[model samples]
Target: MAPSNRPIRIAGCSGSASDRRHAMAMLAANCAHDPIDVIIGDWMSEGNMTGRAALKAEAMPAYEPTFLKSLEPALLDIAKHKIKVAVNAGASDTQLLHSVVVKMVRSKNLHLSVAWISGDEVLPAILDAKARKESPFENICTGEVLEEWKFEPLYAQAYLGGLGIAAAFARGADIVICGRVSDASPVIGAAYWWHRWQRSDLDFLANAFVAGHLIECSSYVCGGNFTGFKALESKGWEDIGYPIAEISASGAVVITKNKGSGGEVSVHTCTSQLLYEIQGPWYFNSDVTAILDDVHFEQLSVNRVALRGVRSGLPPLTTKVGITAKGGYQAEMHWFLTGLDILPKARMLQSQILTLLAPHRSRFTKLTFTLNGTAAENATDQPAATVDFRVFAQAPCEEDLSPKRFFRPCFDVIMQGYPGATPHLDYRLGMPKAFYEYYVTLLPQAAVEHRLHSGDGRSLKVDPPRETRVWPRQQPSCAVTENGVRLGGFGRTVKGPLGWVVHARSGDKGSDANVGFWVRFRDEWDWLRTLLSVEAVKGLLGEEYNGKDIDRFELPKANAVHFLLHDHLDRGVSSTSSYDFLGKNVAEFLRSRHVDLPIKLLNRGKI
Candidate 1:
């Protein structure tokens, strides 16, 4: 296929702070190779945003320090290559980030224009709306009205789109810093600018949206945090390359990685990421609603996959707003139990701790005891056979959650507690720290006034395209199972892990968890759909399934089934006390659950 007029090549350099070193490495690698039109970084995550909000509350700069630090190493190369940089690393303060970037450019004697996209912050708007009783502000996840919130919010920011970014680029910005724009907005903006696409070009925008989503996490499409990690390890995981998207004028996207870089980019890897964190087939972004129900991927060659069949339409009237507030202080302690009767030992420890805290029980708002892991049979090492018992306590004030008052009980019963009781070496685990609760809801997009400010003392207001038509929200259809595999008719069945027949990717969306499961063959789609119904999913979750609402959607083109489990994360990642706060491991845990597999499909040897 002939390329379309200088197809825009955008490289994603960063995922989050955890991948900062690798992100910088990717940037350096990109600098050494052919110049990419845009190098994007995603530094704003739920955890990072909450922390940055707290910092802003404390009168500290809202911009992320690590973002500047990571970019410094490759700044010269970036300028020399004239690679336009875009990042959401501004966190809560894009103005400060803009100034810092400008100073850095001047210090290096480099001529580069820096711009920032603002208007994501809507705390004042929210306050006004609430005071005026404009509308009943309800939490999108919990449906609880804002008036019922226990704590006043410290920060509220709506998720912006790519219009402001595109405007900045049009205004000759060499680097664009943004706060709380969707992670994929940078790539979307770059593609829109390069293609000269209008706001109504939903198809092209949808393609870029999917492409941006794939590479937004940087190494995710390059095999990092992949379900098929064993296969990626063989291809060298340590030096995994970051993802790059080659977008055609028509919106077709080719996902590839840096040449000679480690890790592989195949259909499976791209598919794994495509399914991450999505609510349903209709991916609602502020810019466009990407219809991924028909989206499919094809491997073009080694380390290259072509994304196709995606469609798009006008987005919803409202954009998501994330509000962060102080939820009080939390403290936790861990105890290790080993050998036989692990449950009994954990129970005994919990009982003793509770008995010791009986006098001070009234001070705590909530107390929890979680037992993690089980003893492994024939384990060679003692650590391998140990189970962890965790006690978490939350209170309205730090004094009530102080280590001397709350964590003292755990240490006091060390000698008299259950046999083989041991605690982790980290003493700071007993210290109380403020917890930030996240409340996500929707706000009218028209209410947000997105503006792009250029270094040349010029500002432009960017607005969403005028609505040509309004379409009713699409509801998830029932699971399709007409051609589903019938186990009884397939001779014999064997009980095994579901992973033998399906590939799954799971992630968090506020307090909810979304898990997408797909099959390699189209013939297995019905079987997958039938085998993983809502009831089946609940069963797969076993003890963790808390009888919450579960919505399922089917994607025929991808031969996949997606599920959204509401209120599954216990109140989002920041306040969640669960081990898998982000729900990153939910799919893997489900895959491990034993299920009845058809003998015929197992014998096919394609799984």
Candidate 2:
């Protein structure tokens, strides 16, 4: 079939490991709606990758089991409709996943072609680089060199691009399974294959890149975890729809969701997902470097938004490789302190526990004491006024951090503990479990030996596209003016939550956190822009801000300001001791912060 000017519609099925049920729901929804030409599934996460690596070491299957389980119900429909599937559910074992899929298809007597892409695994290459005395693998966020690591890594995998998957489809493969490709690469590959886009088509590639980023998280772009969830309540967020992208030959895109699915797809929702994990204006992927500063979004109608102005250049020489190592064993416990003097009660309990463990302090690699929530004054319910004191400790091995050794001390102090204190009844939290430490560093893309296997004794090698131009490193800059602007003309001002006039979203990138906020009206953009600077963000973060490096960028077309706070999530989601490990609620916390708003803007009801 010749390439046509009509836009290609592609639907995203799963976002991560926990999205299996929703993913199956989306498959049915996709078949009922304007049928999708391609379906993309992103099921791998940083934590999931580490778990899969551990499984592989034990000589077990390392692929995501949910991938086949969820697809089985819709496999017949997908085959009958000829809807191509490209997914990264292969995790650490693409070859095994390929075999399993082929067997399943044969059992069903389906004449579909299956392909698998490999070579993202770079453990041997990393060992070779180390032996050759190549440059040290410094941690991308913390700058800690690899030589300082105390334990050997369990596995290392580089983030691959979409060219391999695109080539698989070019060879007439109906299903493509990939190991460790970037989450958005499946969408990128599908768009490239469907559009027949050339390697040097940077503009088209950038457009597709932005489109993929917006919908890579499935229900996120459909208002699932939005900060302005109160406003979306009328849209029925319980059964939120999965996102879909309609891409034209020119590379322009319209983002929407399944027709009868719940959730709103407005410009606000799109902007929220755009700022999820980005570091700067330049978003680097293996295929291209997308310049996101000028990307614009416009609401065309209900549940439809048009995207434009995305530009791209050649990607950087390096790709990121995630190295997971057995960090140690960790155990945590919580105690509730109720009513008055909660802080003192928590402190007293902590002091007693530390005193009891003082003899064995040397065994611990790290220990933390955290207090969550504050006792409310004049609260009626007992549980409502309680504060949670959490104790988290890590050691070199499970023997040093076992539940029996840790829990006995807490139990011993309970009889003599402070007033109104009670230990949380969850026994599982005290159990020792191994923790995985993640190290992210860069590797040259040229070193990756990517290849596509057609599953029937046929394979082909793939190479990175030739670079057409040099891409510069993005610098930190803000739209803030040196002199403070005047807000006098707006008449009276009211002190209220920033959510009254702006929508915000925040998420984690390893240990760092990114928050983006925007206003609805163009007139409010200038005031909102001027009010929120890097310094303003620091103030909003309060004590959590500390003195870490922060980067700021302005997306004028989207009327938004974005900030990246380095080392803010306290070592990321998997091993973090923070109450909010994923940083999902950071944006909501900032939105709840009180701010001075213009009376006129509030009177106009523009928010």
Over 4 Å off in model 1, which ranges? 1-4, 22-32, 468-474, 477-483, 603-607
Model 1 error, position 332 (Å): 0.5
Flag clash pairs in model 1.
Answer: none
In angstroms, how far off is 601's CA in candidate 1? Answer: 3.5
All models, RMSD in angstroms: 2.3, 2.0
**Number of clashing pairs per prediction, in order:** 0, 0
Q: How many pairs of residues collide in model 1?
A: 0
Runs with alpha carbons beyond 4 Å of true place in candidate 2:
1-4, 20-33, 468-474, 479-484, 604-607
Mind giving the per-residue lDDT tens digits that candidate 2 earns over 1-607? 2235678787888888788454653564467556687888888887787788777767889999888887777778778777888889999988999999999999999988999999899988887887787958877777778888776887889999888888888888888999899988887888888889988888888888888888888899998787667777678877888888999888889999988778889888888888888888888888888888897788999999998778887877888898878878888888888898877787889899989888777898888988888888999898789888888888888988765568677657888899865888887878889887777888888788989998566888888767834444345566463454576656689998888878888888778788888888887777877889888888888977769888888887898888888888877776777878888788888988888888888886634
Error of 1 at 441 (Å): 0.8
- TM-score for candidate 2, please give it: 0.96
Q: Write the per-residue lDDT of candidate 1 for residues 1-607, one digit (tens) a residue.
A: 1113888889998888666554653565466564477889898888878888888888899887788877877777777776778899999988988999899989989888899989999998888898999867888777888989888999999999997888888778888999999988998899888888888898898889889999999988999877777777678887888888999888889999988788999888888999999987778778888888888899999998999889888877888899999999998898888888888888788888888898888999889999888789878999889888888988889999776679898678888878777887687878999899999877888889889999897999888667623434334746445566665665678999888777899999889899999887777776788777888898899999988888888877888888988889988889988899889999999988898888778876634
Evaluate model 1: give its TM-score.
Answer: 0.96
Tell me how candidate 2 scores on lDDT. 0.82
